[model samples]
Target: MTTKEQLTVIRRLMGFAGPYKWFFIWSVVLSATISGINVFLPWLLQTYMDRYLRTSNATIQIMWMFAGFYFGGMLVRAIMQFWQNYSSTMGAEYMLENVRRKLFSQLHAKGMRYFDQTPGGSILSRLMNDTMTFANFWALLNTLILALFAVVSSFIAMYLTDVKVALWTLILVPFLVMTIWYYQHYSSKVYRRMRERLSQLNTKLAEAITGITVIQEFRQEDRTSKRFQKTNQSYYDTRKAMIKTNTLLLSPMINLFYALGTALVLGLFGVRGLHEIVAAGVIYAFITYLNNFYSPMSNMMDSLSDFQNGMVAGSRVLRIVDDQTLAPQQHPVAGATITRGKVEFRHVTFAYDQEHPVLKDVSFVVEPGQTVALVGQTGSGKTSTINVLMRFYEFQSGEVLVDDRDIRDYPAAELRSKLGLVLQEPQLFYGDIQTNIRMYNTAISDEEVRQAARFVQADEFIERLPQGYTTPVLERGTEYSAGERQLITFARTVVTDPKILILDEATANVDTETETMIQTGLNKIQENRTTIAIAHRLSTIQNADQILVLHQGQIVERGTNDELMAQAGYYYDMIQLQNAAHKD
Candidate 1:
């Protein structure tokens, strides 16, 4: 990212904390108070040395007063520091929480096309590491405030002690400013490179874990390890480059400040013969104050690099939020009872990529309670048809009507609530079997859940498992086989009792026995509902009232099974192929 882009990201991130501006203001106040206490300590030390230690005329009453001031300042400083830490850290956490929430919501609202183009690992890193960088910016802000107080207080104290020495010390300020400016300019580039490499590392690690099964099956573990090593090496190289540059710039800068101060102090005390005139205690105090001044300045400069890194991370997160513009609903559509699941696709045309259309001039109508089956080769637009009907993807130039109303006119939530979908790869989250069944509509009771499971014939296997409906499955239903997961998904769909149902390759991976069981359950669920089945198994959907065969992006054949069989076209050829494979 360029400098302008980074600044924009920082501005956007700061906006999240706009609600907590009061917290930031109080934190800065507390930080400055603590720094002010630090400035008073050197003056108190000088007083203690000159009046109490060097002179025997100092009384016990005066000693106690000095002691009280010394410890009192310490106590007040501690209190201010405590408040500063609490308030600043709280603000950072608050800002991070909101940023994380907004980023997640934005990502969820984005279309499937965005996920197709973005890497999963990169997204994960932005959600995790990027938020951390934003929090670090808060710490840098606190440090800068403290540094400001220290620099101002130290300059006033030094001038009061000795004007000539203060003038000599002030000469190094310009050089110090120039060095920090130069370092910040170059360090930002290094930090940006480091952040990019970190994102790549996250992406590579995610890819390796997600594809571990494929890697092991192909016996390519060594190759995968080698690739990971290359990524890791690149990350290390960038980090090292950043560290090397920082060390070279910062070490010299710190030494230069120290050398300048030491030379000025020595010249004042030795060459000018001022040691007898100036109190030893005052010179010691000046040295301590000078160290205090330079230390925070150096830290502030170093933290500027961290601030740049955080800005880069913030930019990545904001990019997602700004990129996708979600389609808005002006007003909630009045709930219209879908008594009949009549679906009509009127001149619907869609393209996953604009240059290549997936569904071209598609038009179809399904009467209420009718069963329609779509048959097509892979990528022949059967799935795409279902996707558009479900409103998972929008058609570029077409309307999908549900009960004679455009689907777009309905609120997306209400539209989806009326439809049930089961995919080829059924997903079961990490929850009890009962919870999984009722996931689609959680308002349903346990009894209703059981009824749905029984209707889908899932209650049988579920009852056999430990705890029956309460049985907890692992992630992705790892505890159960693929067939079992499909059964659970079917139960979930049945529980919702949607007006329109879509089954996409639902039985493609099951055994004959399970397929028979699924068919029985499907028959029970499909009764009196509008159903669309996309299947390669012609036998399962042979009884469908209508079957549409899609070739490329066009529907080439449409009729009942017997009607299409009589024609002896693409449908006949596919049936023959399946029969031959079965015989073999």
Candidate 2:
């Protein structure tokens, strides 16, 4: 990146400090102050040696006073160091928290197309690992600033003590600067690769874990392990390259410069003769300052590596924040909220990739308090149609009206508040059954929760559990059977009492008796609501007010079940095929 672009990333990362900026500023000030005091200590040592130790009037009391002050100065610096460390750490953590909060909110605000196009593990890597790198960025920045302050202060002290020796010391400064520049150039490229490899590793691991069941069923553990090893090896190689760069440019190189500068100083003293122009005490002080000076410079070089890593990570984070491709969270034009749950799709067309259409001029309508069933072969655009209605993906060249107003007219939150959705796979959080049903909405009373669960027949199995409604659910509600989990999801949707409901039913995962129970619950929830269902079983949607048969991204037939069956068309053939399959 260009210098200006890198500065822009740094300024944006620093902006995340927000209200805690004072903490970070104070920490820098403290570090510089402590370093300033340290520079003064070497000067004090020189003064003590000249005024007391080398003089004929030197006394025991004077030595005691110097010792007391020396130790006392050390004590103060130690206390200041503690405060500096605390403030810097706290500031970095707070800034990290703020960045993560904003990033997460932005992710949630993005349209479904963003999630569809991105991997879950890549997102997690940015959210977790990259954010952590930003935290280290702040810490390293503070250390670098502190080190620079020490280097400058020590240089000034040395120059004031003896200009000739200081000028000789300056000979090696150019080489040190060049070394740092070279390190940054190569380290930035390596760190960027390392971060990419880390993200790939995370993505591969997440996909493998998510599909663990399928892998086990097929006994493909060996193949999966090899796939993971490929990613792991790539990450390991990048890490090794980073380690090699650090070893070459950081401590060892700085120490070499320190040794060169020290040898030059000793050679100057040897030529001048010890007691001549520069005193022995002054030479001792210069040696001490010379060593002290390189300590922070070396530290600064080490921190530059972290700074590079942070900048790369920060750039990734900023890309997500700056992405403007997603539809805005707020509606551009204000209109009435969805009150009646009426929905209409007028010649709607949509494609994930605009080159290939998923829904082609699809037109449909569901009047208020009516249930519309979508029946289609897989990839026939049933789910795409539902996605359009939810405004999860925008449809091209058509108007999707909710409550007789364009979907674009209402704020996403306001429109979605009136709708409920149940996916094919029901997702439950880590909470008790009651909390899952109410979704932790405080406005829902306990009584309302029980009523909703009872309405959906979820209460029958929930009550049978050891703790009933208070029973704790494991991740995704795995402790419960598929039927039981679906029942809980049913209660979750019914509890909202939404004006519009969408169900993508998966009946294959449950037994016949559980399917009947789910159907009864579905009947209760669809009453007096605008319901749209993607039917997996032909029998479940037989009573829908309107049944739309979809084929190849278009509605092939639209009618009530009896009316469609009477025609003996595509709907009839599907029914006959399903019946035959069931009989066999």
Candidate 3:
């Protein structure tokens, strides 16, 4: 990542810590205290060896007092360590929760066009891996703090012991610092590459798993396996390259610093000709302290790669959290109510991409309580029209009005509340049937729930289940058949009692028997509401108040069902084709 990008990501991650300012402060204090205790341990050992060991007044009282101080320090260090872990780890976990929540909200708030442009697996990876990467940043920050304190305090003690020996010991510091800087600069790039490769691997795995049914249907298992193997190999190769470069370039330099420091200490001791300048015990203590200093420095260098990888991930996560939410229109429609369910689209033109207009100069209207059927071939923009009506995608030109007010002047949430949609692919989460039915509305009564279910003909199957409304639905409603899932979704829609109802091929995947049941339920629900149905099968919508035949992003033919049939236009040809196919 570029320096600008890294800084941007860091800023975003830090923003999440705003809620836990006190906890962070406490954690830092505890971390410093523990570091202080660690620094004093070597000095205590030196005192025990040089002073206490050779002293004539070696009383039991003095030994016990020394032991008490040592244990007291150890106890304090242990308590501080506990606080550091609890505060820092909890802070990271809390931040992760907030990040995940915000990401979900932002993703859902985004226009459908955004989802169309992005892949499912790519989004999923960001939610999972990117958040995890940010969490590692907290861990790295704590480690770095401890390492810094130990290095500084140890150096101070070494200097106070003897200036000449300290000077020789300090010779290796510059070289070690330079080597660490170089390692961090180069390894960060390699680690970033590794993270990117891992993300790709995650995306590929998700795709393969989700598309397994399609792969089996097409008998492409061997091909899929080969593709997966290729992705896995690429990930492995990138990781191996990162490890190899780190080992060869970083570890050797680290070992060289240690060797040079040891050589300097011995050479300086001989040059000073002061064998009594620092005691044997003091020399041993210095060596021990030197090891302490080098260990954290080396570990810090080694862990720098993980830290950078996390930083990169944190940057991606922050981008999503920082995205501008779709702001409601400045002038909201005041006290707007659709008493007559009138919808009008005037000169409406829209496109997910600016250069490619999907709907051009489209115009239409539906009278109060009327059912409008939109007929279109695949990719003829039938769904896009519904999307426009729901304001899921903003139009480049034109106005869509519900009743007499423009939709742009309405709060998005308030506007969507009046509409109930049953999509072709019904989604059900992990929960009981009752929870799925109620969804966001908890105050709804059981009578209302049952009535809605009956209105959609879903009560019959729901009652057949062993647990009825209490039956647990697994992820994506895998426990139920496609038709059953559709029925439950239809029930959910009716329970809300939306003013406008949209069925975008709600019965497209069901059997004939299930279709008849759903059609009956739809008839009951649409009696007093504005209904918009999109169907490929013209027969299903033959009785619509108005039928629109869309072709290539334009409504070419539209009228009452009989009027379009009499004209022998696109709808007439399609109905004829379907009838012929069924008979054959």
User: Clash number for every model?
Assistant: 0, 0, 1
Candidates by lDDT, descending order: 2, 1, 3
Number of the candidate with higher TM-score, 1 or 2: 2
lDDT of 2 by residue, 473-582 (tens): 88888888988888888888888888999987655566789988867777878888999989778888899999999999999999999999999998999999999999
Q: Which one wins on lDDT?
A: 2
Candidate 3 lDDT for residue 86:
90
Clashing pairs in model 3? 333-409
Candidate 2 wrong stretches, greater than 4 Å: 274-277, 325-328, 332-335, 506-508
For residues 323-410, write the lDDT of model 1, one tens digit per residue: 8644333244687546678999988899876678999999889998899999989989999999888766767897888899877677
| Better candidate by lDDT, 1 or 3 | 1
TM-score computed on alpha carbons, candidate 3: 0.93
Compose the digit string of candidate 3's lDDT tens values, residues 239-299. Answer: 8988887786554666777677777776676565554464666776677667767776766
lDDT of 1: 0.83
Sort order, TM-score high to low: 2, 1, 3
